[model samples]
Target: MTVFLCDGECEYSYDDLLRHLNQDNYFPLLKTHHLFSYFGNLVKALTNDVPLVLLDSDLSPAELDGVDESLVNQSIPLSVKRLPSMGEVIEALVHSTSEITMFTSGTTGQPKKVVHSIQTLTRSVRRGEKYNNQIWAYAYNPTHMAGLQVFFQAFENLNTLINVFNRTRSEIFNLIKKHSITHISATPTFYRLLLPYERAYSSVIRLTLGGEKSDGHLYNVIRQIFPSAQINNVYASTEAGSLFAAKGENFQIPASIHDMFQVVDDELLIHRSLLGQSDSFRFDGDYYHSGDLIEWINREEGVFKFKSRKNELINVGGYKVNPGEVENVLNAIKGIRQSLVFGKANSVLGNILCAEVQLEEGVRLSELEIRRILKDSLQDFKIPRRIRFVESFSLTRTGKLKRL
Candidate 1:
C-alpha cells in the first residue's frame, strides 16, 4: 500500500502492515499513518471486546482536557500497547460484541459521542472487482463516519488509499496528482475551499459529496473541474449510516427503500433499522424522526428534496425561512464561493434574515450586487435583509461550517 503524506511517501506491503500491527506500541495520535494504525487496532479489537475511541486529531490541550475520563483512559495513544499475554483476551474480544465510539463534529452544537458496530457501519458499502484497483484520496479524517466509509470501501475492495489528512490545499493537489487519485469523498465545504486552487482534476473518476446539502452550484462547479467523473450527492448522518444517493441537483428518495422512509409534518422519518442508535431521536417502534425537513418535489413519483434542519428554521417576522434555501440561492450566484444564512434579532421585525458571504480569491463582489441577484431568485421575506462579505468562514474539524 502507498501512503502519501505532506512530507513524503510511505509504502508498506500487506505483510509489512501486518508486522507493524503486531508490534508492541501504541498508535500515533495524529500522524498520517494513523490510518494504518486504525486498521491495526481494529484487527486487535475484533479479537477482543476493547472499544475504540477516536479523538479529534486537531484538538488543543484545553479541548483534550474536556474529553471524558473513561474515553481518555481507554483511548489508544501513541506510546501504549497491549500486553503479549492478552492472547486469551484478544480471542474473547474477537468473538464478543464490541463498539466503536466516535464524536460528532459539533458543527451544530457540542460534539457528542456516537456508538456503532462494524456491521451497521459497513452495511451500505459495496465491494467487488468493479471497485478494486481504484485509487482513493483520504480527504476526511479516518475517525468520522464519512472517513470510515471511505476507508472501508477501499479496504474491502482491495483499492489503494492515499492519505491527504491535515494537508493544505497545495499539498493535497500534489498528492492527488502524484497518485492519480480516482475516487474522492468529502463534504461540500472541503470541495468549495479547494476550488480556488484550480488544480488539474482529470485523474478523478468519481466524486461523492456528503455531510452537507449538495446544491446545484457545487454540482456545476465539480462538473467543470472533472467533466468525465461520476458526481453523486450522498445523504447520510452519523446516526444513519448511508441512506440515499442522488445524481441530479435534487436529493431524490430511491424507490427501493420508499417504504423505509416517510415525511410526517415536514420532518423526514427513516426506519429505525437504518440507525446505529435510536434513543436520542423521536423513535416509534419502526421509525426514527431525522430532525430534517423535506419538501415534495413530485408527489406522484415519490421525489423529494431536503429543505433544512427543523431546528435551524429561521423565524422572519413569524414567517419561517429555511437558511439552506437562501444559502443555496447565494451559492448559485457567480463569484460567491461560500455563504452562511441565519436569523438575527430585530426590534421591529422580531427576527430578520442575515447572510455572511465569502467570495472566491481575487473576486470582488458587493452586498448590493448579491442582494440584486437574490431579488431575482428568492422571495422578499426569504432574502437576507443584511448581507456582509467576509474573507472566510469558520469550519469544524470535520470540514463542516461552524454555525454560530
Candidate 2:
C-alpha cells in the first residue's frame, strides 16, 4: 500500500501508516511470511472471522486450494493472496497491538482471543528492541507473538528485512552469506535442520533457540557448526510468552524469579507475560496459576530445562494446535465413539498432532470425512495432518488417554 523506498541510509520500506508510529524512525528486523498469515487471521478475529481468501507470496494455490471449497459456502469466500514488499504488509498492520488480537494455545481447552491494545503490542516491541539491536536476518514471522515481536523490532530499527521464502537450508545459507546476516532466532528444530548445511556459511553472529528444547541435541551441533557464534535458550509459551532465558554457550541458571511464578506441588506456575514487560519478559508479582509441567536442569543452579509438555498442544510448522479441538469434531460423527490426540515428533516442526479415533461396532467411516469436518471448522493450521483409526483406546490409572 504505502511503500517507504528505504534506500537512503535506511534499508527498509515503511507504510504511510508509519507516519503515526514514531519519531525515532528506525526498527531493525526481518520476518518470514507466516507472520502475515497471522496478520490475515488477526484482522478476521477482530471482525469475528478468518478471511476466506488469503493473499500470500509464500503459498501456492495448491497449498491453499483445499482450504474451503464448498460451493454454497464458497459464498463464504476466504482468499489467501500474495502481496509484494514489506511496506504493504505494514500498511495492513497499521493499527498497534492495542488494536491487535491475541489467541491462546487452547491446550487446556478452546483457544481464547485476548484483545491487546496497540500500546500492548508496542510495549512488546519496545521491550524486545530495548537491549537488543534492531538488526536481524528477518527469519521470524508475525502470526505468533514471537514472530510479531520480530516484525515490529525490525520496523523500529529501520534495518533491512530480507525475504527468501521457500528456500532450503543451502539457499538460506547462501542468502546469509550474501547479506552478512547478523542475528537469527528460531526454534531448536529449525537449528537442527540448519546444521546439515551449516558448513555452507560461517558468518552467523548470534543464534537464539526456543519453541523446543536446546540441550545437547541442538547445542552440540550448533557448537560444531558456528564455534564463534553465541547460543541462547528461552522458555516461554503463547500465553505466558517468554519468561526465563540464558544467553551465550555456557548458560548459568537464573536465581529466584523477580516476577510471575508459583510453586504448586513443587512445580512453577507462570502467568501470561505482561505484553509490555519490555522485549525480554520480566517476572512480575502476578502469580498466574500456570498449566506448564516442567523441571529444572539444576544441581543447584536455577537454570531450567524442559522435560516434556503436559498439554495436548502441538506445534506444526510453527502453528499451535489443540488435539481436543480436532477430537471434539471427530467425536461428533454419528459412528465415532471416542478419539485421542497426540503429537508425533517431527524434524521440521517440533511436534505435530496425530489423531486416533474409534468407531461404533459394525460401523466404519473415512478419516477424510472427519478431517473435512475438522478442517472446515477450525483453523486449517490446527487440523491434524495425520489421522489413524483405533479399535479402542487404553486409559491410565488417572483416567487419561494412554499412548499407543
Best by TM-score: 1
lDDT of 1 at 241: 74
How many collisions between residues are there in candidate 1? 6
lDDT of 1 by residue, 213-243 (tens): 7687788787877766899888877887777
Residue 326 lDDT in candidate 2: 64
Report the lDDT tens digits of candidate 2 across residue range 1-404: 32222222333234432332322221111122333323324433222222222222233234333233232112232332233444444444444222443344333443444444444444434433353433365544334555555555565444444553234567667667766666676654345345432363456667777654345434655666766678776554445455556763233334554444555554466645444232223344655544444555563565554444445457788876656556656655566656677788889788777888777667768878888778667887677778888765554211124543
Best by lDDT: 1
Query: Which runs of model 1 end up more than 4 angstroms from their true locations?
Result: 1-13, 24-33, 47-49, 58-97, 196-200, 252-256, 298-302
TM-score of 1: 0.84
- Number of colliding residue pairs in each model: 6, 43
